[model samples]
Target: MLRLIIKKEIQSALRDTRIQFAGTFLILLMLVSVLVGRQGQKQIQKERAEAQATMYDKWVNQGAKHPHSAAHYGQFAFKPKPVLSFLDLGLDNYTGVSVFLEAHKQNEVLYSAAQEGNGMTRFGELTAALVLQVLLPLLIIFLTFNIFSREREEGTLKLIHGQGISMRKLLMGKVWGTYALVLLIFIPVICLAYFLLDQASAGFDPHVGVKFMGLLASYSLYLLIFVLLSVIISAFSKSSSFSLLSLLGLWIAACIILPKATTNLADKVYPTPSQYEFRKTIAEKVENGIDGHNPSDARLADLKKQVLDEYNVSKTEDLPVNWRGIAMQAGEEYTDQVYDHEFSKVENIFKKQNRVSEWAGFINPYLAIRNLSMAFSGTDFHHHVAFVKAAENYRRAFVKKMNKDMEVNDKPGTEDYRVDKEMWESIESFSYEAPDIGKIISVQWRSVTALVFWLVALFTLASIYAPKISRL
Candidate 1:
C-alpha cells in the first residue's frame, strides 16, 4: 500500500508542468555552476604553485650575504589551495593566502580574494554549494508546500481519505515520494560535481570520495527534514497560498534572517579590537618596562650576563663564541613572548565570538551545515590558524639556525660577518598540510549534535502531526 501511494504521488507530480520545468531548469543551472567553480579552482591552484616555486628559487640562489641581512630579506610562504575547497569555498575568499615570514616580526596572511572584488562581492559568489544549500531548498518548498493543501482543496483528498486510508500512511507516502523525486535531481547533480572536482584536483585529496559521501549524507538529511516540515505545514493550511507563504517565512528565517541576526548579535556581545588598537596595545606593553627604554636592550643585557656566567668568563674578549649573536636571539625570544601573550588574548576574543554561532546551530540547521562545510573544506579559522602557526615555527627555526651559524663562525664585534650561499641553501622551504578530517570534526561537534536533533525532531513531528487533520 505504501509503495502504491508513493507511485501515485510520483506519477501525478511528473504530470505537473511546474515540477518538470523547475527540475530541468535547476539541473541546467547546477551544471553551469559546477563548470564555473571548477575553472576558478584550477586557476588559483596554478598561480599559488608558480609563486611558491619562484620564491624558493630566489631564496636558494641568493648570493653570499650577512646572516642578519638574510634574516631581514625574509621569504614568502604561499598557502596551497585545499583540494576540497573547490566544492565549498567556505572562508577561503575571506582569509588571506600568502604570509611574509621574517625575523623579529610575525606577519598576518595577506591578499584575500574578496578584497579584490567590487561592492557586490560582499553578497557572495554563486558556487554549486550555494545553489544546493540555498536555492534547492526553495525548489523543494515549491514542489511540496502545496502537496496536501491542493489535494484537499480539489476534493481529491476527501475521496482518498474516505477509501479507508489513515492520514499517517498518507503523510508517510508523501514524505517518501517527495524525497524520491528530489533525489532524482539532487543525487545526479552531486555525483556530477564530485566527479568534476575529483578530476579537477587530479587526485590531490585521496579522501575526496569520503568527503563527497559525507556531503551526500548531509544534504539527504537536510532535504528529508525540510520536506517533512513543509508537508506538516501543508496539512495544517487552509489553502495552497497559505502553505507557500508559511514555508517561505520559515525558509527566510532559516536561510536569511537568522544568519545575519546571529552574526550581528555575536559582534555586539564579543567585539574585536580595531587593527591599530590591537597592534598599539602590544607595542606599548613591550616598551614601558621599569624604565621607558628599549625592552630588547634590557633583555640583551641579561642574556649577555647569563652567557658570560655559563662560560665562566668576565670579559667579552675571553668568551670563545660571539655574544652579539646570542644577544640578538635572546631579544627576539623576549619579543616573541610578548606577542604570544597578547595574541592569545586576541585569539580568546575571537573564540568567544565564534561560540555564539556554533551554538546557534541548535536553532538553525543552516548555520550548522555552513560551519561543517567550511571546516571540512579546510577553509575555516582552525585550518587558517594551523597554517599560520606552522609558518611561524618554521621562521623561528630558520632564524635560529642563521644566528647559531654566525655565533660559531664570526668573531665578536665584527660588523661585516657574511655567510656563504651554501649556508643559506641549507634552510628548508616551508610546506603546509591541511589538518586531519577527524580534528575538524572534533572541533565542530556542536554542529553535528544539532543536526542529529533536527533529524529526530522532524521525524517525530511527522508522526505526531499527520494524524491531526480532522478538518477540511
Candidate 2:
C-alpha cells in the first residue's frame, strides 16, 4: 500500500509541468555552476603555481649577501586552493591567498580575491554548494508545500482517509516520493561534479573522495530537513496558497535574513582590532628587546657586556662568536614572542566571533550547513589559521638558520660578512598539509549537532502532528 501511494505521488508529479520545468532548470544551473567553478579553480591554481615558482626562483638566484640581509629579503607562502573549493569557495574569496614571511616582522596574509572584484561580488558567487543549500530547498518547498493541502482542497482527503490508509503512511509516501524525484535530479549533478573534479586534478586523492561523500551526505540530510518541514506545514495549512506562502516566508528567513543578521550581530559582539592598532601593539612590545639595526642601543650594549663578562673578555671582538650575530638572533627571538602573543589575541577574537554563528545553527540549518560545507572544503578560517601558523614556523626556522650560520661561520671582526647562493638554496621550501577530515569534524561539532537535532526534531514533529491532519 505504501509503495502504491508513493508510485501514485510520483506519477501525479510527473504529469505536472511545474515539477518538470523546475527540475530541468535546477539541473542546468548546477551543471553550469560546476563548469564555471572548475574553470575558476584551474585559473587560480595556475596563477598561484606560477607566482610561487617565480618567487622561489628569485630567492634562490639572489646574489651573495649578509645572512641577515637575506633573511629580510624573504619568501612568500602562497596557499593552494583545496580540491573541494571548486564546489564551495567558502572563505577563499575573503581570506588572502598568501603571506610575506620576513625577519623580525610577522606579516598578515594579503591580496584577497575580494579586493580585486567589483560590486557584483558582494552578492556572492553561484557555486554548487550555494545551489544545493539555498535553491534546492526552494525546489523541495515547491514540490511538497501543497502535498496535503491540495488533497483537502480537492475533497480527496476524506476519500483517501476512508480507504483504510493511515495518515502517517500517506505522509511518509509523499515525503519519500518527493525525495525520490529530487534524487533523480540531484544524483546526476553530483556525478557530473565528481567527473569535473576528477578531470581537473592530475590524480584525485582518495581522501577527497571521502570529503566528497561527506558533503553528499550532509547536503542530503540538509535537504531532507526542508522536505519534512514543508510537508508538515502543508499538513497543517488550510489551503495550498497558505502552505506555499508560509514555506516561502520560512525560506526567506532561514536562507537570506538570518545568515546576514547573524554575521552582523557576531561582528558587533566580538569586534577585532584594526590593522594599525594590532601592528602598533606588536611594535610597542618588540621595542623592549635589543635593537638589531642599532648596535649602540642600551639593550645591545648591556647584552654585549653580559656576553663579554660570560666569556671573560674585554670586548666583543675578543669573544669567541660574533657579538652582532648573537644580538641579531636575540632580537629575532624577542620579536617572535611579541608576534605570538598579539596574534593569539586576534585568533581568540575570531574564534569568539565564529562561535556566535556556530551556536546560531540550532535556529537555522543554513548556518550549520554553510559552516560544515566550508570546513569540509578546507576553506574555513581554521584552515587559514593553520596555513598562517605553518608559514610563520617556516619563516622562524629559515631566519634562525641564517643567524646560526652567521654566529658560527663569520669571523668576529668581519662586519660585512656575506654568504653564497648555496646558503640560500639550503633553506627548505615552505609546505602545508591541510587538516585531516577528523580534525575538521572535531572543529565543526556544533554544526553537526545542530543538524542532527533538526533532523530528529522535524521527524518527531511530523510523526506526532501528521496523524492529526484528518481532523483538519
By lDDT, who's the top model here?
Answer: 2
- After superposition, the stretches of candidate 1 with alpha carbons farther than 4 Å from their true spots are 202-206, 288-295, 413-415
Clashing pairs in 1: none
Tell me the TM-score of each prediction against the true structure.
0.94, 0.94
Q: Mark the regions of model 2 whose C-alpha exceeds 4 Å error after superposition.
A: 202-206, 288-306
In model 2, state the lDDT of residue 22. Answer: 90
lDDT of 1 by residue, 1-472 (tens): 7898899878988898988999888888877776777777778978997898888888887778978778878888988887767667888887888998887888888888878767776778777678777888898899888899989988989898989899999998998898888888887788777777657654555555666676667777777877778888888898999999999999999999998999999899988988788788777756654234656557667778888899999987778887767776776676677778878787888778777888998898888888777777777888888888888888888888877877777777666778867887788778777777677778888877878888898888878877887547
RMSD of 1: 2.3
C-alpha local distance difference test of each model: 0.80, 0.85
For residues 247-349, could you state the per-residue lDDT of candidate 2 as single tens digits? 9999999999999999999999899999999998778767753233433366677888899899999987898887767988888887888788889999999
Model 2, residue pairs in steric clash? none
Residue 39's C-alpha lDDT in candidate 2? 88
